[model samples]
Target: MRQKIIAAAIAAAAVVAAPQALASEELNFDAYRQMLADGNPAELFEMEGEELWTTARGPKNATLEKCDLGLGANVVVGAAAQMPRYFADTDKVQDLESRLMHCMDALQGIPSAEIINGSFLKGERAKVAALVAYVVGQSKGKPIQVDLAHPKMKEMYAMGEKTFYYRTGAMDFACSSCHSQDGKRIRATSLPNITTSKGAAEGWGSWPAYRVSNSQFWTMQHRLWDCFRQQRTAEPVFGSDVTIALSTFMAGKGNGHEAVWPGVKR
Candidate 1:
């Protein structure tokens, strides 16, 4: 009986120590991230993105250097930080990818259908991702200040809040399921609670990032689509209103946070 008691005490102590072990393991992860940061692979994509922006390839044979990103044509610097904002031309709240499609079609004369219909990591779609990285790099460390004052912006905000809490997947999992809780991780990746300002900034500010696992750049739209896939939910169309609305909600929550667009990720 004394031996049994000793075994039970040992098990209890091990259980009590588990959390500390987990924390140390997590700190080691930070070390890994720091190592990657020394030679971030995103630099390669940034170079490619810059080239894609200047080299003309569409049927019209025009470079995207003249494309207007809300501020004005040829104004590439610091544009990514102000995105997912209302555009007077669309008279709607459009996110970065949708706005890029508009520019690609109108300025470069690329077919909107062709651009929007393609997969994210392939063909012209890949080029779009690269271009996004290049533009977002131009705004690194800028403050995230997406405007939400327009009438359409207000409407999108309301819809986004509703969607954030809406649960309809096979697992009945909404984004809030993983993100609402603090100190949670999935497959060793720390999950930030994006409903609050700090969490939102951490989550939202590091997008248009380069994903090393895929060896490709991911825009916000691509990231959200992949989330839905992981959720076992129906895939949303690229640049759909729901996606853009969610972008507005996240970006708004991240207001005043420093931009780290084109961020490097594992």
Candidate 2:
């Protein structure tokens, strides 16, 4: 009887200890993130982008040097910090990738269809990602300064706020389901309360990141698509208003934080 009771107690203790042991192995995110930051692979994409920016391509056989990024033409330095801003030419708010698409049309005559239709992050889409990296990298260490004064900018921020809290799909989960609260996470990744200014800045400031899991760099567009897919909701089309609006909101929230993108992620 005594032996059986001791065996039962040992079994119960092991069962209780199993989850804690696994949790302990999850690793310190800051430590791992710092380690990954040392020799980031995203730098490769930046190099490719610099070449693409000047290389003659598309039907027009022109480079993007003449393209305007809401700054003066071909001005890259510190331009990305104020992205998703309104463009007078398009009369629309444009993020980095969206603006690049416009440039591809205006300067290179690359049809929007040609640019939009593809497997995610391949061919021209991958080229766009490279472009995003290059442009955002130019703003490295600069404070985010998304302009919200434009009427379109204000509208998009409202829409983005709505979308963040809007819950749908099979799981009926919203962005807030995982992120609005403090110290929430899935597995090892910590979810930030992106609705708040500080959380929003931290959440928004460090994206267009290189994911260690898939060995591919992800743009902000890719990040949202994945989020919707994870929620079992409809995936957003590239450069759509919903995507732009969310990005606008994040960038608005991210304003004042120094850009830390082309960043490493798990």
Candidate 3:
């Protein structure tokens, strides 16, 4: 028993000394990321998205030019920061992807299934992602300002907060486990604590981004789906209530930060 205790003490000492040992390596790694930021390929997707937004297509042959993003009809610029807010027509708080689905269905007469069935890099779904990129880009440099005033909006906010912290799955990992603390990392990627304003702004602001590994445009919905898959949870239905609720939580947390969409990702 004494020998076992001595071994445990050594193990604890090693963990305590680990960060100091790796500190220099961590600095070098962060510097590498800073270097990559200059020429990120996400700009390609941003350009494609801009074209898709105004270009007309489909059987009925309509562009998304007149699509409403909750501010009013045909208002695209700077609308992203205001999202995850309550919409009277829908009578619920909706996020970027859900709101985009609404516009695609109502304005273009596109079936939601067809859009969801489409690949992230091809077909109607890609177009929606592009539109999001363009719209969110317009809000670049503008402060994030998600509203939670309406009663239903408040309810959704509460639900979202609960969901963010609730842990269940084979891994027993909640979003908070990885993100509740600052300066944690997984596989060299710095995990931001998205529950806080600073972290939320950083994470939420940079979606509709180009992913380096996949070489494809990824919207917020795609980001969330991938997260769940990694968590070993059942995949969320595209733009489902749970996803939107979580988005509401993030967006509300990020209020007052700028929107920087079509962001470059490592």
TM-score of each predicted structure versus truth: 0.86, 0.89, 0.84
- Per-residue lDDT of candidate 1, residues 50-134 (tens digit): 8888888787888887777878987888788888888888787887778878778887888878867888878777778778878
Could you tell me the lDDT of residue 182 within candidate 1? 82
Candidate 3 lDDT, tens digit per residue, 1-266?
64365345434543443354456565324443344355445544556667776777665577777777877877877788888778888776778777877777877788888876666556777777767777787787788898888887778878888999889888998888788888888877888789789898877887867654445668889998888988888878887888888888888888887766657554
Cα deviation at 50, candidate 3, in Å, is 2.2
Winning model by TM-score: 2
Candidate 2 vs 3: which has more TM-score: 2
Off by over 4 Å in 1: 1-24
Q: Indicate whether candidate 1 or candidate 2 has the larger lDDT.
A: 2
Model 1 lDDT, residue 110, Cα: 86
Superposition error at 17 for model 1 (Å) = 30
Q: After superposition, how far is residue 104 of candidate 3 from its true place, in Å?
A: 1.6
Backbone clash total, candidate 3: 2
Evaluate all candidate structures by whole-model CA lDDT and list the values in order: 0.77, 0.82, 0.74
lDDT of 1 at 147: 82
